[model samples]
Target: MYSKVVMDHFKTPRNVGEMKDADGMGEVGNPVCGDMMNIYIKVEDDHIKDISFLTFGCGAAIAVSSMLTDIAKGKTIEEAKKITNKSVAEALEGLPKNKLHCSNLGADALQLAIKDYEDRKAGKVRPPARPEDRHEHTHGESCKCPYCNGDVNAGLEFCSHCGKEMNDSH
Candidate 1:
């Protein structure tokens, strides 16, 4: 079952496409569920001037992607970073319990986009992909996220859990 807000967003998803000149881009997927999301952002003077997304998922995923963009537009990067899966679901009047991962992926995608933008601005190289979940690998690295004091790997661009940049090298 879906809430009215969820249904509305599902049927009329907003900002539902790729951006050609995005300042930042993020992509995330759930292999088990076969859901994927890509978020694009355009920043101007430290503010999110625009945002968009492309999602290969269910109605909940599409709806969350749309809502995530709406929540980030016109906000500063820091403010946008504060957006979370919980807030996204709340914005939609709450997603089905099982569909909450849709909101998680949406928020993660946006955070990753911002990390990409910051990395580019600071002239940092992207990390090589690893097979394991970054969230899991972080625990073995024995370091904490500077922003949230949560576990993170040395090479990660951002904390998998809190979305905090893992280091200041960038």
Candidate 2:
């Protein structure tokens, strides 16, 4: 069952539209669940001046996206980048076990949006759409440890560089 906060957010999602003049945008999808999310952000003086999203997903996914924008807006870029899947889920007072993945979609989309904003500010070319293209490692081959951003081999239980347990949350 969904939490009251979840239901409230789903019934009246916030920042629920696209921004044509957004400074950065990110899109992500979960093929298995058929959930897709697009996050748009506008920055000023290194802060998230505005944020919005368009989510094609279940109620939980919609709620997560709504909460994510609320959490990110007005925060500095560095602060917003720290918003994680666990944080979003906690903000909603927690989601059903089966719907936990929805939080990941929201956080990942936000991270990608922030990265796009940074890249644009640095005058760097946008990376390709593929996950592997955005990351240094090949998809399913390896990934950066969420704790330390160290290269971690796929399927590892703990990050070799950070020694942190890799749980379902990460």
lDDT of each: 0.86, 0.90
lDDT by residue (1-170, candidate 1, tens digit) is: 98998889889988988899999999898544558899999999999999999998998999999889999999999999999999999999988888998899999999999999999899998787676643333234567666777766665688988886554432
Q: How accurate is candidate 1 locally (lDDT)?
A: 0.86
List the RMSD of every prediction in angstroms: 11.2, 8.9
- Residue pairs with clashing backbones, model 1: none
TM-scores of the models, in the given order?
Answer: 0.74, 0.74
lDDT top scorer: 2
Q: Model 2: runs farther than 4 Å from truth?
A: 30-32, 128-170
The residue-by-residue lDDT of candidate 2 on 1-170, one tens digit each, is: 99999999999999989999999998987443468899999999999999999998999999999999999999999999899999999999999999998999999999999989989999999867776433333356666688898988666799989899875444
Report RMSD for candidate 2.
8.9
